[model samples]
Target: MTDTQPRTGAPAKPQGFAATERIESPQGGGPGRGPMVGGMVAQKAMTFGPSAKRMVRRMRPEAAPALLVVALSVISVVLMSIGPRLLGHATDLVFRGFLGRRLADIPSDQLPDAAKAQGVVPGVGVDFTAVGHWLALTLAVYVVAAFFGWLAGYVLNGVVQRTVQRMRQEVEEKIHRLPLGYFDRSPRGEVLSRVTNDIDNVSQTLQQTMSQLLTSIMTVFAVLAMMFWISPLLAVIALISVPLSLVVTRTIMKRSQGQFVAQWRRTGQLNAHIEESFSGHALVKVFGRQGEVEDVFAEHNQGLYGVSFKAQFISGLIMPTMMFIGNLNYVVVAVVGGLRVASGQLSVGDVQAFVQYTRQFNQPLTTVASMSNLLQSGVASAERVFELLDAEEEPVTGLDVPQRDGGGEVAFEHVAFSYDPDRPLITDLSLIARPGQTVAIVGPTGAGKTTLVNLVMRFYDLDGGRITLDGVDIATLSREALRSRIGMVLQDTWLFGGTIRDNIAYGRPGATDEEVRAAARATFVDRFVHSLPDGYDTIVDEEGSNLSAGERQLLTIARAFLTDPALLILDEATSSVDTRTELLVQQAMAALRADRTSFVIAHRLSTIRDADLILVMESGAIVEQGTHDELLRADGAYARLYRSQFAAVEAA
Candidate 1:
């Protein structure tokens, strides 16, 4: 209700769009229908390394919490790594006690030569107390490790989620600051995907991968240290698998990274397609293009499937490949350990611990390799979000200029503009509207009728020249100040989900109930509201689809009425209403326009017949300007347009 005008300042028609004229630019231009997926394409293309680094920086704000997570992960892995060594000791004590109990039954001298050479103690009965102690310690180690692991993941989740929340806020603010021309070229659905689907994907990918990745990496290092502690030679043998795992994982990631980027990019395109197709579903049925739409959907869906399968399949190679290398390394270490044990160079318990360490070392390598998919997918999404965040913002200028009291006198001093620089839409055009005058603009479809009004509203900054209201340049005034004095009703109605009274109240927040009804009565809306079940309380759907076109237009007009602006604009204001209601709206508008400057852009000659002044335009310049009767007497472009329009009606 507070900000009815679009921040982009895209023009609402002279009539139907009451307040939301600024916003409809992107939504108005259906997302691009390129032969390929360009609508949702990233503004800037990026690769895994840079995008990943940027994502890391985004989390820098949560460094303290992130460090806490790392500390926990380190503690967890180190504690867990100690357990296998303890278990190896327990195994040694049990073996020794078993041998001692058996040997004690015989005399020491009568014991086997091997037992004597090994220095086995006699009369030891299993040493249950010692074994029980070792077992309890190992249990404690594992339980603590598990606790730390859980805490690490919990803290990491909050850090990543908070970062994502900030990213969303940045995107929202950026959307408000982006220029209208950006949307004119970009697809609406594509913009929406970046904000909604892309950001969500990024959040999911980061939360799922970050903590697990930390733990896996830490486990590798911790287990390596323990392995080397047991025996340098065996540790070196196990170390061979590290480089081999890296080689395999790196190769697979390089191949899968491109596919992951394509997968998310295709996802954006698919979303854009779905959004556009469904938004205009009625038109599709009316034109009988359902088969065509289905074919396109199938094309997009198939592309996504193929890319997704490749990304997953390629990243999927890491786990099994790493495992194969790990198992091979395990075999080499086992053989070496057995030979050393046979030579009495290593103790039975030490060899046992070394074997367990090998597995612990290889396990984390495998885990990190397996997680490449989520990491790549997340970085791919991060790049898309970054592209949006980096888009050029509208320049903040004209703040040094001053303001003046409103008299509703707008002047164009040699204004020049174009949708594209080479293709001018308006050039060196100048006109003046005195206070209390009704200025009607009539032109062919591409005659710059809407452009003239948009310039006055400062929707687009001028390439040259200046426009002023009450002798104060509009560019100097903030968009907020300029728009506050102007009210508009464009050709297409914009109504959000709200009660009838609320929609009107959007024009003026905190409006009294009586004030709302008074505006409704002026626009002839009150006549129909009471017939509905809730009268003024009746709720309208988001698009106001439940209401007839005329009723929707009337609500918008009533909204403009409540604003009571110093300047008014109506673009085909009565285009939707029946002739009977058109008269009522016209009367209401006249009362509203009294003592205020009003601009009307219309094609209907009868509508502007009584205007104080009329301007005729062709291409990018005005060809004539005068009263309607004066133009009729002159028999120029305006006269011909008028004669043709009425002639067509007579022929019908």
Candidate 2:
């Protein structure tokens, strides 16, 4: 089949995630609200409220399994904590036995039977055998707990990695579905960092911080319970420090949150600058602006470094402060318990157990303080990602239009458009092309020729008026249904990093190898393909950099031809080709245009001389429209454009 034969079925429209826009409220409101109170609440709430909730909601669906794994790991921590307290109890027993012997000062015959039988003082009750049994049991529990802890960690890591993978995939899919305008508005490096660096931060939190946080919490709870069981008075004294530690942690986090956000923003800026510089390195070299660019980069890099240093400096204070508080609690427990034991209010064993419990209680607090930094960083990264995911999508509301059936008859009626509504790009533009007719759009730069075609394809909605395909409004049709009947080839071709066959098949995924080869031959792409070492299997590097401009354009033409759409658009198709290549491409285009409606945008005036109708546009309006011969006879805008091109050709 020829390139003009329309393929069956429709191409799927890109899918985008749903996002809602809403103004968030401050922390609180009351009947007696004041301006100062409201301002403080708003500031505080903005930092820790809606943004955080949004991030968690975006991440939680995928992170559910990981969260479960974390909970399981927490359970293992609790079991392990039990072992530590048991070890403390065993230690207390040994200390008690030694203390009893020293305090009794009695001969072995005077000790109780049980103590005497074990070769101890007669009236003094100290069981060494019993202590040894308890020690062995504690050791066994420790071994078992350690084994489970390792297992939990191993499983949790796998779960977290998988969760991260899903999140990355979802983000990638969402980006693909989003309108091209979104990318135009956002910096490339900033978007990329959200997917890469930000996701990596979340992954770190999942794999490391999450586990540590769980373990720390479990340890604290278990240790606190054991401390209370041993001695309520000592437990109360140790617990007094908990409130103080919490206050300190809260203060540090509150101060550090804004700094962390600033740090992330600076990092994104630095990444953006680096990416922009590297991507345009050739331009920098050509313009002799390498030194200027380097200076710019250094400024951004320094900004990032400063922000990061400040954030880390603040976050790093938490762990040391926590440790200091923990040590103070330790001192209080020691001094109080020692006084109690001297007064005969507590046994040596009881005092030793309480000390161990105090140490255990502090362990989780220290861990939680250390992990706070990572958790906050992850939260910041997640917020960035959700910001993108929460961006508005293109409108796709109308659904009353009829589907096209491969007969391309496009008409624009008083179409107007503007990338920004305040500045109109096209105004009151009208054009039409009948089925099986070829139309050439000739215009000066910024005359809205490309915008006209973009309207027909519904890339951007018209600000006013309507576009219709086969007598049906394009807006009423599904985007996929409308675009399925059209094929486009542009001067700047983009080929993915894959084999030539793969690239060609991308236009029609299910196209047979025979059909692919036929399309290539029709476009004269086979000649170049055969010359390559691997023919159809040859790999094209990034953006088809391995091929010449003309060659890349031909490959794109081949792809468009392979799709076999009823309507073909050649937007500056011959702009990049040499004279010889242009002639070849023009001939191939003519063949592809047969029995189909085609819109040609040509700088080379000769290629479109045979078009059924020619529209000469200037300032978003068609200044002249007629057959090529009639326009030439009229000596209007089309004639001037033709003459200018002819003069340039002769000069060349």
Candidate 3:
């Protein structure tokens, strides 16, 4: 790729400059493409059964609201079940009223009772008054049932929302507790998809399934009770379809569950592909990778489409199939009820109630069966979320040291570490920086220079040994307490969307306007700010894309200066700026370094030459350590690097 992204894309592999090497901290990546993109990396995702149960258990904190929703659902279903029976009574009244009119000419008692054994005497005429009363009661029952159903739905919404809100907060907090190695090993897109897309899917799934599932289950049981009460013979016929319904649901659920897993897995991959492509778009174009990127995107898209279609298609068959089975049961129930009514053993009203109960029972079966799709998708997303919450977190520090009030002494004691257990990096390395010393670290790419500074910041814990600040073991200090008195200006300059003045003051929150301007002037940020139309008030976009590299770098310098920290770690902080601006920043940095312990990482030729100590590292160990002149006198690693590097620059 001919074009290089400004430290934001996965840098084109450290092309002979510290600028390109900025993100090569063995962990951090530009944009969202972190070092490793392990799909289900390093761990197996939880299976559906456990994940579904876990999802339900996550709502334990919202138990009160959840219980209320359950109570409402029961009330709603029980009320709704009564409506069918009342309507059946009205139907019987209407039929007897109409039939009685035709039999008016015959004497009353000699004629057979025409109320179909309902206990009403053979009538001389229609009874419109009784039918009206039954119809009114049915309407009132239906109205009340509808109200409770809506209330249940309303309460379920809040319960699901609060549960998801807590979930989002936990995930956010977990991100901070994870070790830098986690990001080093997992792609940024994969993590984001789990955080955002997967969680959102969980919310939607719960919203769609929660109240409806409750109502369906309640309706199934309650309606079955009424059916038995009306007629045991007809109820038994209806019960025959229960086993058939269970078999269909269980088979389809088992098969479609696997499809859902594949569907989400493919979604994560597609998201990763899109992220890497967009972050490195300039490189892709420079290398004519449009077709390659598109082809890969197409591949992932097709994979997702195939799995999603299969999952949805399989789940969709449930509703109609269940309906078909219910219809068959409906036929048997209706025929049997009609026969009982004709034999005069059962009243027409009772048979009418039994037929209505059959329809109500089947409706719930259809509903619960169809909801299987949402349930599968929801559980799949829940498993991914659980995987993150279950990730091993950084060891929690148990003690807190007071913040360093002045220039701090930092020491690294026999530190041993590695990203992978099999491949060791930075083993048994040791060093110390006295208060007010300017210690410079110089090395080639992958020489463990950035790894050294990272140790001081505690980005990764040592596999062995300890780091101490001002005689206090940092491992005993809370991470925040230890980092409180330190300021870092990395080669990768970052600025948020804020005023230029605010960006500079970020180094020290609550600083006065006067103090902010002082730091800005000291770092030459004010020099350029005055030339712009909005000056300090101009709003910079995220990462300061509107400003030049040197401008962004200077603002970061101002931020570090504003803090006036006891210890400073500048990792190639001046590499992005121009020569004149770098010189000014070095002077400002020199003043800033006067009483504070500062660790400066840079190429030997670029750093302040009057450094009190210089360390040359190779293959994760320091091969040489001394002042610049003393190292040159030794004619060792430092001397050779300077001779080779400076000699080439001089010739040019």
- lDDT score, candidate 2, position 234: 87
What is the alpha-carbon lDDT of model 2 when measured against the actual structure?
0.72
Worst 10 residues of 1 by lDDT: 1-10
lDDT of 1 by residue, 1-652 (tens): 0111112333222221122222122334322232222353334558788888899899999999999998999899989999989998887788777788887878878876555534457887577788899999999999999999999988998998999999999999998888776665566677887899889988998888788778778888888888888899999888887887888888999999999888988888788788878878888898888998899899999999999999999999898898899899989998999888766676677888888888888877887788789889888888888888888877876664335666699888888776655455555767889999999999776566777777777777888789989898888888777888889998888899989999999998899999999999999999999899988889999889879999999999999999998889998888999999898889889999998899999988898898999998776577888999999999999999999999988999
lDDT of 3 by residue, 148-248 (tens): 88988998999899999999999999998887656655666778888999999999999999888888889889999999888888889999999999999
Clashes of each: 11, 7, 0
Off by over 4 Å in 2: 1-46, 49-75, 100-128, 398-404, 643-652
Q: Residue 405 error for model 3, in Å?
A: 3.2
TM-score of 1: 0.91
lDDT of 3: 0.80
lDDT of 3 at 161: 95
The local distance difference test score of model 1 is 0.81
Candidate 2, residue 533: CA error in Å?
1.3
Winner on TM-score (1 vs 2) = 1
